[model samples]
Target: MLKFFSEEIDFKLPFPQKTSKWIKTISESEGYNIISLNYIFCTDDYLLEINKQYLDHDYYTDIITFDNSEEEGKIESDIYVSVDRVKENAETFGADFEVEMRRVLIHGLLHLMDYTDTSEELKLQMRAKEDECLLLF
Candidate 1:
């Protein structure tokens, strides 16, 4: 199952049903099944506190993912996104707000599929995968 939520923010995610279906399609294509997935939308400050309290990072970020799967091929997690950051990122990248937001959304799912962006090479690959997934939508 996939769900979208807003916490401490007045933003509503666009096309929740389509987004959830796309996420499920990506997960199944990557050989995993979704047990449960939640997307939490909030402001930059709200997400910054989560980053600090949980990740020990003081910087503001676009997304924070908490993976909760106890076994392989299963996904259960909470993904927090900053709508404030998404808007800025959209402008920074010259992309539409919804496009950038969906990228951030799927980026978290890609991580659960064993994709990492810790290095430059890995980041490139991750970006390619994200692009490919975006095209599928």
Candidate 2:
């Protein structure tokens, strides 16, 4: 299952049929099955507070993923995304809001799939994967 929630924001994403199809397609392509997922969309202020509290970053970011996957290779967790950051990044990346939002969503799921971008090389790889996934849209 996949769901979306909006907090401190008033926006609606694409319909669940398209969203679910995209998510499931990506998961299957990545060799994983998404048993469940929860996506929370919030403002920058809300996400910043979460970042400071849980990650101790004290900074702003587009998305933060909380993994609730019980086993080493399972899909079950909550994904938090900031609409404020997504809008800003979309402009910066020269893409529309919908496109950028999808990128962030994929990014969070990729993290759950054990993909990381802690380094330049890894970031490049992650970006490649993101681009590849975007082709499905």
Candidate 3:
């Protein structure tokens, strides 16, 4: 089952229903049932610390996902998202805050599904999948 784990959140996001709907839809579409998901919404400072501690990076980002799955497909892990970054990106992208938040959520899910966005081509494909899943919601 898909679940959320808030660490240090400022405010609750709108469109939580839509987010859940898309996650379930995407999970099933990928031929996997979500055993559980831990979403930790926190400040940029918090996420930046996590990034440094876990990823060895010294920059701030929107989301970071940790995936744990066995060969038989049992999935578990924690996904950390920065609401501070999400708000800024929403403004920069000229999209609604909820929409941008969902985009971040989908980004993490895509990673869990073994999709990468490091290359231009891969990013394009990932964005396409994000768009397709967004439409489904």
Candidate No. with top lDDT: 1
Report the CA-based lDDT of candidate 3 relative to the real structure: 0.84
TM-scores of the models, in the order given: 0.98, 0.95, 0.92
Per residue, candidate 1 scores C-alpha lDDT tens digits across 89-131 of 9999899999999999999999989999999999999999999
lDDT of each: 0.95, 0.91, 0.84
Model 2 compared with the native: what TM-score? Answer: 0.95
Q: Candidate 1: where is the Cα deviation over 4 Å?
A: none
Best by TM-score: 1
Winner of 2 and 3 under lDDT: 2
Note the residue pairs that clash in candidate 3. Answer: 1-35
Error of model 1, residue 9, in angstroms: 0.5
lDDT per residue (tens digit) for residues 1-137 in model 3: 66666677766756666677778788778876677787789999999999999999999999999987764345576899999999999999999888788889889988888889999999999999888877776
